[model samples]
Target: MSKLDSSMRCHAPVPLAASHDRNARRTLWVVILTAVMMVGEIVAGYITGSMALLADGFHMATHAGALGVTAAAYAYAKHHAESGRYSFGTGKVGDLAGFTSALILGLVAIGIGVESVVRLVHPEKVDFGDATFVAVLGLIVNIVSAILLSGDHNHGPGGDHGHAHADHDHDHAQAHGHAHHGHHHAHGHDNNMRSAYIHVLADALTSVLAIGALLAGRYLGWVWLDPAMGVVGALVIAHWSHGLLRDTAGILLDRSDAQLAGRLSAAIEGAGDVTITDLHVWPIGAGCHAAIVTVASTPILSAEVIRTRAVGIKGIRHLTIECAGPA
Candidate 1:
């Protein structure tokens, strides 16, 4: 067992993400925009006696806070990458931020649902004129915020922080002691940016719905439609929150994607007399994975030889090989 241990441990460079700085800057700008609009709406709502404006202003406050979480996560991950605090670095910070954002979104949905149900039972005299004006303003702000947060995808065909670019992949044998063979393409969505974008999208959706409900209440005398729309919007928002929650939770829990594992295995075991005794693979960052494999071979192949054949699975940024020979 001691002879099998090569005393060589290698890890991939931790991610700051391909678009981390750009996305962080954009999210910060959105936080500023949301905070400013939130204050403006709250002040105007009190002056104009518009409950719709007041509620939307508070909603924007939550979004600002959520986006702040995203920005902080990026900063922390970048700054602490070499701090050695996390076993796999702080790349997972974004997943935690996304998970927190989803929980906040769920709370917002629950609040809206409860308020809508209450309003439906005991209808209040809404200031339709003022509400319509605020709703329009909210829509404009949301559209701008959405434009700022949208399309922050990292199009780089490598793992986060430059894991397997074509030029870089050629040096894995010298660098990591294990040469990855055929695959150098690894990409994952920037989930932190995605969470922030979803917040803006959710706001835009609710604003549009509010405008429709306000118009119906103001002109068509269908005041009930206002609360009805709130209920519907809450349900839709909850669904979005649930999806984000599920994805982030899976990443945080280190749940391996089975499809990814199968692809990785096919590449490693496709040739040679290698049979894996144990394999563990899990995501360490957005589009990057860390794998530990224990293998048995009749001729007792070197770990390096096995890795030379295992290189084709795209997202495996880090690998640890333990060779079990005949004793």
Candidate 2:
């Protein structure tokens, strides 16, 4: 009987530095723009005694803060990509940032909901003229910021390599006894960027609701609409926050992607008379995954053979295979 054991580390096929730079730059610009708008709204609200304007301004401040975190995370990840301290590199830095931002988003949602409820219970006099102008302005700013951040989401460090197999010469690499590095594969979404985009979108949504409420109250005397819209916005924000949290948390917890794992399992078992005893898969960066697999096979089958069979599975950049055979 013979046993073959092999371990391979595959770097993500796409270059991350450029993507990181792009995201960081975009986030920074948005932060600056958001901060300026936030301050303006706050100052104008105070000057004009418009509670709606003040509240929206405060909301914008939170958006700026969340975006600032995104920018910082991108910069940190880019700067530390080559640092040996990160076992899987700094790819997941964005995920961490995303997680934090999600928490902030959830809090913001709660705050909005709570404030809306309070206002609904105790309706206040809103300066429609000033508040409406600020709300419209805020909406415009949010729209512009969203556009700025709307670059190709796929063109980042976490760019997907779903087609990594198409260009991969796996057999050739095996024959040459060289490990594959930086082979492209389809990647999943960049959670960090998504989180940032969500923040901007959420803010934009609130601005729209605020505008509608202010308009309705000004003309139709539907003052309750303002708080009602806030409640709706909060619910929307909460929903997005929950989704981001779930995804980022799954990655941080090393949850396996079921679909990818299923594909990997099928690929391995199809190659030979092998039974997979154990398998573990987790994302290490955007659009990249690492896996460890244990297989039991006939005496004639070697680990190299199994490894060859598992090649071309997209997004799997690192693999460790252990093969056991009858003695």
**Candidate 1 local lDDT, 1-327, one digit each (tens):** 323323343444555566677778888888898899999999987997778779778888998899899889988887887775676677789889989999999999999899999999999998887778877887898888777766544421111332432111222212334343333433466767778878887888888898999899888999999999999999988988888888789889989768767876777677857787777888787677787777777776766676666565566767777776643
> Which stretches in model 1 have alpha-carbon errors above 4 Å?
1-12, 153-186
Candidate 2, which segments miss by more than 4 Å at Cα? 1-18, 46-50, 153-178
Clashes of 2: 7
- Lowest summed lDDT window (length 10), candidate 1: 165-174
Residue lDDT tens for model 2, 1-327: 232225433433333433567778888999999999989888987897778678778878888898999999998887877776776677788889999999999999999899899999999888888777877888888889888888865532223433233122222212222255454533456778888889988888887998888899999999999999999999999999998898889888998888888998999998558888888878777777777777776653555677777776776766766666542
Distance from true position, residue 144, model 2, in Å? Answer: 0.5
What lDDT does each candidate get?
Answer: 0.74, 0.76
Best by lDDT: 2
**Residue 312 alpha-carbon offset, candidate 2, angstroms:** 2.2
Worst lDDT run of 10 residues, candidate 2, spans 166-175
Native-structure RMSD, model 1: 4.4
Local lDDT at 26 for model 2: 82
Q: How high a TM-score does candidate 1 get?
A: 0.88
Error of 2 at 264 (Å): 0.9
